[model samples]
Target: MGKTLSGKVVVVTGGSRGLGREMVLAFAAAGADVVIASRKIEACAALAAEVRDQTGQRALAAQCNVGDWAQCGALVEAAYEEFGRVDVLVNNAGMSLLYPSLDQVSEAMFDKVIATNLKGTFRLSALIGARMAAAGGGSIINISSVEAVQPEPMAVPYAAAKAAVESLTVGLARTYGPAVRVNTIRCGPFDTDIAKSWPPQVREFMAGHTVLGRIGDPGDIVGAALFLASEASAFCTGSTLAIDGGFQ
Candidate 1:
């Protein structure tokens, strides 16, 4: 069978590593031109080169801090300048630091989490989804976490922000429908770069909660992503597709 996502233009925030990088590689391999967006231009550029070399598909590296509203606009402008239109948008840039307690969660930390994980998704989806709606149709995929619903031992603020992301997906789907599709990938514990720092117990705890008896890997998400990004999910919108390995 032919690879999916042919002739598509996909923009992946946080594309420098982990799940984002995996998606970029997977999409390019499936014949899609990809835009790699991250706060670090060097990383994005490096990945862009790799994508081009590996898949021979056009790739653009654009520096963007999804936490900043203005930066989100710039990213969109840059994507359009290169690809003309974004057929798929993956809101994957996010951060959450563990603190001793919720009381210790500083205002700055809370705001940063909300801005990066929630506000940025809102702004990008609103702008991109509107344009996609106008230009016919496209897909907006938000990267959330299982913590959004099930409270994690740490990163409460982050979990809250992610919950809002899922809400944003449904809202955008309603607003931009008949053309644009907004969906959320409620991810579970994955062995991404950030997870490398997690203590052994925490890691084991997460893995044990899953029916699969393990967390996910970067490559595991590509299939669901490609489905949502391509025409295969034509009937889906305002959907929350969980890639949690059946978290308990």
Candidate 2:
């Protein structure tokens, strides 16, 4: 069989690092031209070069802070100008700042968390989803979190924002469906470059909660993303997929 995403154009925000980076490479490997966006243009450009060299897929790097609604529009415009159409949009950029305590969380920190996680998802989905709707159809994958439903201490604002992301997934699905599809991936802790900084004990504790008995490997998510991005999921929409290794 042919590659599932061959000839597709995929735009991935936060494409410079973590799971987003993995998905960018994964999609490119499946023969998709990729547009990678991050606040750091240099990092995105570096990844773009790597995608072109490794997969021979066209790659464009755009510096876009999705938190800024304007940047989201510009990013989409650039992608369309370069590729004519975007077949998939992965709303994957997010951040969680640690505060010493709930009481210590400042207005700025809370707002930043919400803006990055929630508002950014909204802008991207609305902008690209509308375009997808108008252009017949496309797939939109929102990277939510297990924290959205299972909120934890120290990242309250982030959890709240991701909770809103799940809501966005359903709403966008309804608004754009019949052609366009919208979905969410509720991610669990994963073993990525970011996890290298996590304390060893915390890693062990997280492992204890999963049926798989370990954190997700970076490539573990590629199958789920590809399924949703391709015709294999033609009947699925407005769904929140838990890519959390059956967390308990």
Candidate 3:
């Protein structure tokens, strides 16, 4: 992966941990200068340091609350200031809360889930999409979830937001056209903080859904991100690469 993204600049939201963190390392390994953003300033800074140490590539840590429009703007601006250009944007910050069924869902929980997962992705996509368009071209990778398609009983709101993400991926691809590529990866169960937070029973159930009979690692997504970011996927847009281990 040497220099596949050499001299490129990338921004990965929620990059302080989990899949977002892995994507930060992946991009840096491919020779891209990366901006890692999350609400946790210390976490971001620590990840930035680790990335720079491991990959020897420039990495910046920015505190960003993706639910806030002004904060998202600042996140984009921070990326530009750090590297002067953004060649790729990965909208990966999101949240979820599981319950028995839709009846168990609360209005406040629904709103918060939608705000972070849907509104955040939408806001960041608009900001980065414009910059990519103005710069003549770039890639936008949205991280969706298998729940978007599988639609488990416990994750109604999460599934809805993720489904919306898939739609946004396609819509943006259509509108941006040959200028900027927009794509998505409908990620399956992964061994991350999100999964660990799930109740033990749900975790066991998810593990059985995959043919692999195991949860996924955060690094499982690196290849898809690399392909979309590199020229290898130049012709790919409006596509949803399901990294689900045949869960569906």
Candidate 4:
């Protein structure tokens, strides 16, 4: 593993399990002190212990509800207090709400998806970008989905929200230039709990959707994240790195 992130401090939201968990370990391996956040404090704490045990880096776990601005503000403050500063911020907390069609989706469900995925990302990025500007500069990575571009018709709400995330990535990069870099990673179907929640047949069909002919694993996302978090992507900003296996 490369130590591209040596001495860096990173904040990863939803860093309890799945992609979020993988990012925490990956960043730790890259020699960064990491702050892990999730709604479940216990899970985040457990992951933090694992990071410390395995990587011997400073690790912190904080309970956070990303959709709440106050919680997001406190999360940033706590991370800075623990690590002195944050050089990287990964907006990795998101959820999907699927329905047959937009017409069939209730207003509440639509609002929930929008709030958690789109609004949460905006709130966190705004706070972090301000801090990064004040502190010179930093990088922000937003986790999006290929579904945003390809459009899962039945999962309109999810697609719409993820699309908004992509838009926010570019918008923030433009608005906070010279101080903060912002980008997004668009991932394809993966063998994660989020995908497992689908119907068995649907899940099986998704496995074949990728040209790679298999669902991606959590590790598949780590390398790209590490590159974005490090100086490797010093010139890259306001772009979407698609980790979809030729699905686009």
Candidate 5:
């Protein structure tokens, strides 16, 4: 996949750590100049430096809280200002809070979950997808979660937001189609930073639940992400690709 994205500019939100960070590095390695955005500018800048030094790809570091519409707009502006064009956008920023119980999920927590996981994806895709369509063509990938389909009581708010994201993917694909392709990546239990917080029994259950008999590694997502970002997935859109280790 090296050089598959040469001369292309890619933007990834939540690009500082975990799966987002992995994609940033992989895309840079594939010869795409990348914009690394996250709430923490320091972390984004650090990753940008690594991309530049290690892969010789130009990288832009921008601080953005995708949950806020204004910040999402600013992120779009900054990316275009730096790269002039965005060939690929990965809506990877998401959050799910720990609540004591369903009845105890506060209003703030619910709103925050929706804002970060759903609203942000919508705003980013709408803004950047329009630009991409006008420019001829590009790709938009929304990172969703398996909880959207298999909801757990503990994270109902997050699951609901993700479900909305899946629906948003279809609407966006239609809105920007014939030029800009939009799709979703419905992820399962992956051994990301968040997984570190999972209790031992929860981890064990997750592993046993997947047909692969294990949670996914960060690198496991690279192939699918690269495929969708490149021409390999030219015919795919408005679809959800499960990288869930055959979770059943």
Candidate 6:
């Protein structure tokens, strides 16, 4: 983590909190200038200030709703305007809304899930990846979920979107290979703010079901994220790295 990403400019969507926030801080601490993008500008600005003060790295706080195509474009423009170039793009923004049942799921609900989890990733990756490739080389990291492979009844829309994201990762790698590296981190349940909504029994079940006998911490994602963002994963692309503590 010592200047591993020195002089690099990284943009992380949904970077104001949770796993995204962890990656933003890690990237900044590792010597990368970061652009923190999220719907919450206040949170983004607060984190950006923390990064600058603590890590001594340049940080730009941007308001971006990745679900919207126009906002995605503005985010890319903002990052480039602030940093001149982007060396890493992490498509980390995502959402999963609960519906009463499959039949009760409204079109808006389904669309929103797809837009945030899948469409945004595609748009951002396409925009930034092209620049990365043209600039010689760079890395694009897509944050996926275990739901992509193991679909649950309650989160079908989210699972479908994430599955598309996995496929999108491979397609993007092929599209921007030999220069721009594209990969996915398929994650399992983590003890983040989201877990606060879970009942004690649910949490217990989640912990017990994982091979590690515990849910992942927010920082658990930092290692894989750093590897993918830095030269440690130079030969990796179009790969899915599972950081799920062996969830089965």
What's each prediction's TM-score?
Answer: 0.98, 0.98, 0.95, 0.96, 0.99, 0.99
Q: How high a TM-score does candidate 4 get?
A: 0.96
lDDT of 2 by residue, 1-248 (tens): 24789999999999998899999999999889999999999999999999999989999999999889888899989999999999999999999998899998999988889989989899988988888999999999999988998898967899999999999999999999888999999999899776898899989988998898999998888989998999999999999999999888
- List the candidate 4 regions with Cα displacement exceeding 4 Å: none
Where does model 3 exceed 4 Å of error? none
Task: State in Å the error of residue 103, model 4.
Answer: 3.1
Candidate 1 residues lying further than 4 Å off, grouped into runs, are none
Comparison by TM-score, 4 against 6, better one: 6
Against the reference, the lDDT scores of all candidates come to 0.92, 0.92, 0.90, 0.89, 0.95, 0.95
The residue-by-residue lDDT of candidate 4 on 1-248, one tens digit each, is: 97888999999998898999999999999999999999999999999899999999999999998988799889988988887899999999988776766788898898888888888799989988988989999999999998898887777788989999999999999988878999999988877778767787876677778788777898999989998998889999999999988774
Better of 1 and 3 by lDDT: 1
Per-residue CA lDDT of model 5 for 17-119, tens digit only, reads 9899999999999999999999999999999999999999999999999999999999999999998999999999999999899999889999999999999
As for TM-score, the candidate ahead, 2 or 5, is: 5
Using TM-score as the measure, name the better of candidate 1 and candidate 6: 6
In the range 49-70, model 1's lDDT, one tens digit per residue, is 9998888999999999999999
Error of 1 at 128 (Å): 0.7
Provide the lowest-lDDT 10-residue window in model 5: 1-10
Poorest stretch of ten by lDDT in candidate 6: 202-211
TM-score of 3: 0.95
| Cα RMSD (angstroms) for every candidate in the order listed | 0.9, 1.0, 1.4, 1.3, 0.7, 0.6
Model 4 misses residue 194 by how many Å? 1.6
* Candidate 3 pairs with clashing backbones: none
* Model 3 worst lDDT run, 10 consecutive residues: 96-105
Overlapping backbone residue pairs in candidate 3 total 0
